[model samples]
Target: MKVIKSNGEIEDFRADKLINSLIRSGASIEEAQEITNIIQLKITKPTPTRTIYRLAKNLLKRTNISSSMKYSLKKAMMRLGPSGYPFERFFAKIMQAYGFETEVDIVEEGRCINHEIDVLAFNKNTVVSVECKYHSSAFRASDAKVAMYVYSRFKDLEDKLKKKYHKKRYEGWLVTNTRLTIDAIKFSRCYSFKAMGWRYPEDGGLEKLIEKKKLYPITVLSIKQDSLQKLLKHELVMATDIIRISNEFLENLGLNQRKINQLKKQARALLG
Candidate 1:
C-alpha cells in the first residue's frame, strides 16, 4: 500500500528519482546505484531522514576493495570531501530548527583582523559565534587547536561587530560530531560557554537544558524522518560526479584549442 501524505507516510520509493538526485549531487550511475542498494538494505524501519543521513555518512567514506562486494568503507573523510561544508550545513540546520536568525560563514572582527565564524546567530540583543566539526571519531587534544583559532579570530570579529553595530552582548558556541575533550569541557564549564557533541545528549546530560529550551540539541537521526521525507522529495546526490565531469570537459576543450592553434601554426609554416 502507498504511504499517504496526511498520515506522515513516505511516498513510493523511486529508484530512478533517487538515482537522478545522486547524479545531481555529483555521483556516477554505478556509485549512485551502489549507495542506493546500501540505503535500501539499511533503512528497514519507517524513517526517511535517517535513511538519507546514514546514506550520506556511508557514501562519504572511502572504499577499498579489489572485488565489487568486499570493500572496506572505513577510511577517514578529507576536509570538505562530501556534502562540501557538511558540518557547517548541519550546524546551520540545527540553529534554524531552534528558531535562531542565523548566517553561515559570517565574518567577525578579531583583535588583529577579521575572522570567519562558521555560523553566526542573532537572538534579540545577543550574538553567538558557532564553530562546527564533523569527524569519524572522538575529538582529540590537537583538535583544540582549531577551537582556539576560532576563539582568537572571533574575538576580533566580535569587537569589529560591536563597533559596526554597537552591540554590548555576545556569546559563543562550538558544535562537533564527537563529544568535547575533558579539558574543553572543563574550560567551557568555567567560562559558561556553550558546546554540544554527539554523545552529550545520549548520556542524559542535556535533558534538563533541552527540557528548559536553554540549549539546542542536535535532533536524533531517528526522529528526523520528516526531514528525510523532505529530503527524498528535494533530490539525491553522489557528492562529486557532475563537477568532476564538468571540470574535465572544460580542460579538454582548452587542450583541443591549444592543439588547433599548433596545427594552424604548422599549416602556416608549410604554406610559407
Candidate 2:
C-alpha cells in the first residue's frame, strides 16, 4: 500500500487510495485499474512512483500523447496523500500560465453557504472556476454529485455576481487527471465545461515539449516507513522540503514565475 523514498522515508498509501488518486487525475476506470495492477505486480522498490514515471514516459512515446496529459498523469502517479488539493493547485498554476489571474483553494460565499472552489480565476470581464481531480479513471457517481453540487451553487453565485458587479457570467471548468465519465464529458462539451486530456496536436507541440525535455516529470513516492515512524515519534521530517526541492527543479529548468508560484502553493498546502 505504501512505498519508501530513496532516502528511506516511509509513507502510507492504499491501493484504493491510489485508485481514487488516479480517478482524480482523470484516468478512466480501466486505465486506473491497469496502472494499479501494474504497480502491484511489478513495483518492488523504495519509490514506485518512479517506476510509474518511466512506464508513463513509455506510454506517451508509444501513444503519441500530449504533454499536458502526460503532466496530469505523472501527477496522479506521484501524489502522496488523499486530499486532491495538490492537483487543484496545479490547475490553478496552469491557468495562470495560460494568462488568467488565479487563486488557489478559494472560499466563495453565496446564498448563506461557504463554498470552497479549488481554483478561481479572473481576467478583465471574465471570471472562471475550476475543480480539479488527479484520478486514474473516469469520474464516478460521487464525482458527479460533488460537481453538480458545486456547479449549482456557483450558478446562483454567477447570476448574483453578474448583477451586482456587472461582470461577465462565470465559466465553470472541471479539470480532471483522467477522462470524464461519459455523462460528464457529454455535459462539458454541450455546456461549455472545459475538460483536459483530449487531443494530441498533429504537430504535437505538447509532445515535443515533453520529448525535447523542456518539461521534466518527476515522480516521488511518500516518505519511507522508518522515516515516517521517526517523524511520528517526534523526530522532524518536514514535507515542505519537497517544496524546496520542487522549486529548485523548476527554477533550474527555467519554469516561468507563474508555474513556480503554482507549484510552490501546492507544496505548501501539501506539506502543511
Residue 108 CA error for candidate 1 (Å)? Answer: 3.0
Cα lDDT of model 1 by residue, 152-257, tens digit: 6555576666776576477777766555676676656555666666445345332222223322211211112343223222221111111223333423434344
User: What stretches of model 2 exceed 4 Å from their correct place?
Assistant: 1-80, 136-147, 163-165, 197-272
Instruction: Using lDDT, give the best candidate's number.
Output: 2
RMSD of each predicted structure: 17.5, 13.0
What is candidate 1's TM-score against the reference?
0.44
TM-scores of the candidates in the order shown: 0.44, 0.48
Candidate with the greatest TM-score versus the true structure = 2
Q: lDDT per model, in order?
A: 0.48, 0.51
On residues 1-272, what C-alpha lDDT tens digit does candidate 2 reach at each position?
Answer: 56764456767545676665555444566766666676667756556555555564444333332322444534433342234654555455456555788877767766666677788887877788776655633332224554565466666566655665575656777665544456665555565555443222224322232333222222222334443333223212223333545455545545556755765554443323
Least accurate 10 contiguous residues by lDDT in model 1: 64-73
